[model samples]
Target chain A: MSLIDIQRISRLYQMGTETIHALRDVTLQIQRGEYLAIMGPSGSGKSTLMNILGCLDTPSGGKFVLNNSDVSVMDDNALSEIRNREIGFVFQSFNLLARSTALQNVELPMIYAGVPKSERHKRAMDALSAVGLADRVHHRPNELSGGQRQRVAVARALVNRPSILLADEPTGNLDSKTGVEILALFEELATKGNTIIVVTHEEEVAQHSRRIVRLRDGLVAADEILHKNGAAAPETPVFPPIHASAHAGPPPVPPGAH
Target chain B: MNLSELIENCGMALRAVATHKLRSMLTLLGVVIGVFSIIVVMTAIRVLQDSIETSLSQFGKDVLVIQRNPAISFGGPEVWEKIKRRKRLTPDLGELIREKASLVKSVGMQNGLFSGEVTSPYGKTEPSFSLLSLTPDGFPAKTLSIVSGRALNSSDEENGRLVCVIGSKTAEALFPNSSPLGETIKMDGISYLVIGVLESKGAMLDNSQDSVVIIPLSTGMNRYGRSPWGLTILVQARSQETYNDAMEEVRGILRTARKVPPGEADDFEIFTNDSLIEQFRSITFAVRVGAALISSIALITAGIGIMNIMLVSVTERTREIGIRRAIGAKKRNIMTQFITEAIFLCQVGGIVGIALGIAGGNAAAYFFNVPPVVPVDWAIIGFLVCAAVGVIFGTYPAYKAAQLDPVEALRYE
Candidate 1:
């Protein structure tokens, strides 16, 4: 069975006397280890769909089966539990706590999950290292560059080992070079058998994913298979050179610089 | 929540508070003042009460006083007039109690009239000291120790001798130097021999206790005539165990001696050191209730301030709440975080207030020449009340933050 199965889901919003349909009768299925991108313009209902898929919001109508559990009718508390265990969200704004270190931000989800301290710390360090931010673990969000902050948010999303790594406009706030580095990290994560669902407006970001689902006017416009399993991902710029511009000045040399 | 999670929430709350240092301090000021007001008053009252207790205890344990009026009375001129009209307890009442009350250890009659000069060849003192006229047992009954010379003996009273005992201050004023014993002092056209000097007792309620003189009751009556309303009877019980029995016996004798019928109440009043303390406590109890009410009003106002700040914090951190919610934090966790922050502020304020209150109170006590008191129970109540105020005021704002829709909050500016 698919990891997530959505059948004819709809989301409605009421503004004064008007009824606005954010999503209407949308059907989709996502298999495990799939890297899919949902792309649309603003108000095209992609955000609503992302919110529903991430279990942050429930659909107005239809079933949402995540890991074979029907989460569509779940209450807020149950949805929170499911979200914690099954989904990891990376927002467009790199929503890391401004006062906390990168490692602490990464450890936040596991803290809510009641992970043991030593294990949580170890996992958090591992996740930050995975995002190539091991040396920046002690730096707060304000002390980090935009790209580094995004990496901290990605590490936080990946720390819990959730079933799907969902990102909403993941590169929306980053420059092209930094955005490419984040895309490369996502590609690497996808290659390791992690399912990733990215919602963005940029076709360039969607091109790196294995599958592209396009949304328009609260409905799916097209679903295209861009690459098969074990296939080469669309060219995302390599890391070190891209990171040069991630920090505005000359690259901050590591403590043990040769 | 687990200990680590609670710690984590507390850490977050601390960070938030640290970021807005000025705002948090302002918010905490209200609580500090509220707590300070209460703790200071309570500490002062405790210290004063302790000092009063020690001073009153100088009248000796298990010693009762027979006077024309109660030791303490409340109300206006009407009540005072009635008390004033009661017949005096004369020296005969003391004799009757000594004769009839087997549990009585000793009985002495004294007059509270001390408006007279104490003169000597060396120096003369103004009429500012209290003079007591009593038999030999008066010193022991009033816990008045003899620092030097000898107290008046029964021979002095029986023979109507002009021997007198001087208080520490009076001796200092009358002799300045040299032993007062065997010295002659002329007063009211008569010469009296100094026999004893009382120990230096400290001030009571800011009144000088050391300035006093004592003479035999027989001599006082012979020289000055029987004081119509100034006679005071002192009775010492055999022991604390027989105190009530002694008092009952004295009452019965006085009633019979004064010709009060069986059905009628005694016109005079009977009291002890304990009764005086009890009356003082009752009066101060009203003051304590008033202080508590005023302090609670201030605390409630402070609580309202905390609630307002918390609400503002919730609004300012809407996006943060969204991020936390999306990352798997339950509403309860969010609520816990905000409430913990509010409670942290109040508790910090409470601790500082308590310290200040104790310090301020002790300062007042020092000025009043009383020992300081900790008032442990009031401190505990202050802590609990601060925590309670936090919870009472914090819940609504915390709930508001927790119940925010993650989707809407994420979009909030």
Candidate 2:
């Protein structure tokens, strides 16, 4: 069974007299240990899909099964619990608390999880060290560089050992060199059996992931699979829509795949 | 929720407060002044009460004193005029209590009428010194003892002998080198032999307790003209258990002796040590109420100031709240943190006020020449009230912060 099972989810917003459809019956599935990227332009419902997947918001319609539990109808408190335990989100802004040290920011999630002090401290240190920021644990966000702050955000996301590491526009604010470093870090995490989902409008960031799911106008446009030994992914705008179903998943169609 | 988490939240709150040093200090100054105002007044009153208690205790616990006017009176000159209409308690009332009241251990009469210079062949005393005429039992009733010579006797009172007892101050003044016993002293051109020297009782209510001479009551009545209200009578009980019984006996005797019929109030007033203390509390009632009014208004205003600053803090940290909520913080967590910060400010300010109040109170004690008191009850009350102030003013802003939507707050500038 897939780790995440989404069956035709929909989201709607009412602005005064008009009903705005953010997402309309969007269907998707994600397997364990998959490094996937969801890419689309602004207002293409990419952000809405990310919010639903991360459990920050519940869909207005359809079912969301995370770890075999239907979370679509859960209340706010239950959703908060799921967000804390099952999803780790890294935002584009690297939202570290300005007054807290890097280690304290990293320990924040486990605090709500009611982790003991000694264990929380040890896990926070280990997570910071994992992101190559061991020496900067005591430094606050204002003192760290943009790249370092992003790493701190990643450490905070991973500290609670969530099921999926979901990042929204993860490298949008970083320079190319630092962006490459973060993408490489994600690649290494994926190789170590950690599921990652990066949502971005930048094709360069999507190229680093193994699978790319492209959305256009609140609907899936293409699903691409990059071969393991391929030199690079194809730079193409047009691809046949491979609408994966619940019974029968996506078929192998890329010519570069073995 | 847990100790460690509470500490972590406190650490965050402290950091936030430290970052805005000037704002927090000025904000808490209101609390300081509020707590300080009441604490200072209460503490000073505590000191004054302590000194008054020390002085009033000299009258002894098992004694009931009858006088024409109450010891401490208020309510303006009308009260004084009403008090003046009451008949004077003459020496005959003391004699009646001594003879007829079986519960009383002794009855002592005093007439503090004359204050004149007592001249000896060696030296003379200041004219400000007092001369008290007393019966034989007045020495024990007033807690006086003769350190060198003997006190007045019944023979001296009945025979109206020309004998006097000098206090330690008068002894030292009239006879610097020679013994005051057997020395001749003249008061108002009347010669009397100094038969005894009284012990020096240091002071009472800023008055010198030792600068007085004692003569027999008969001698005083004869030499100085006796008036109707010149005598004050004291009746002592055998033990603490019979104090009320003795007071009833004396009251019944005086009422009948002064022709106070049934269903009529006694013509004279009676006072005891406890009654004096009770009167003092009522005397300070207005001052206490005024202080409470002013301090409560100050504290409420201070609470408003606390609410104001806390609201500003919540608004400023909107993004921070977003980050925390996005991480994992529940609504209650945000609320707890902000309330803890407000309470911390109140307590910090309250502690400073308590310290200043104690210092100010002791300064008053020093001025009154009484032993200093800390008034720990006021300090504890100040602390609890500060916490209440914090909880009262801190909750709304914390609720506001906690109610913010994570999505909208994240996008806030």
**Per-residue accuracy of model 2 over B1-413 as CA lDDT, tens digit each:** 77766888889878988999999999999889888888888888888888877766656677787888787776798878887787777787788888998888999888886888988999999997888889998878888889887999999999999999988888898999989999988877888899999887775443445777889999998888666355778778888899988888788888887888899877787889888888889988888889888878989999999999999999999999888877777788889989998899898889998899888878889988887888888899999999999999999999999999877787789
Q: What C-alpha lDDT, on a 0 to 100 scale, does residue B87 get in candidate 1? A: 73
True contacts kept of each: 0.75, 0.40
Q: In candidate 2 chain A, where is summed lDDT lowest over 10 consecutive residues?
A: A249-258
Q: After superposition, how far is residue A48 of candidate 2 from its true place, in Å?
A: 2.0
**TM-score for chain B considered on its own, for each of the candidates:** 0.81, 0.83
Q: Give the TM-score comparing model 1 with the true structure, all chains together.
A: 0.81
Query: Which regions of candidate 2 are displaced past 4 Å?
Result: A228-258, B84-89, B110-135, B139-232, B239-241, B258-267
Q: Which residue pairs show backbone clashes in model 1?
A: none
DockQ of each: 0.61, 0.46
Q: How far is candidate 1 from the true structure (C-alpha RMSD, Å)?
A: 9.3
TM-score (chain A only) of candidate 2: 0.89
Off by over 4 Å in 1: A228-258, B59-61, B67-90, B108-232, B238-242, B252-269
lDDT of 2 by residue, A11-125 (tens): 9988999987677667777887888899877777888899889877789998999989999988767777787888888989998888899999998899888999899999999
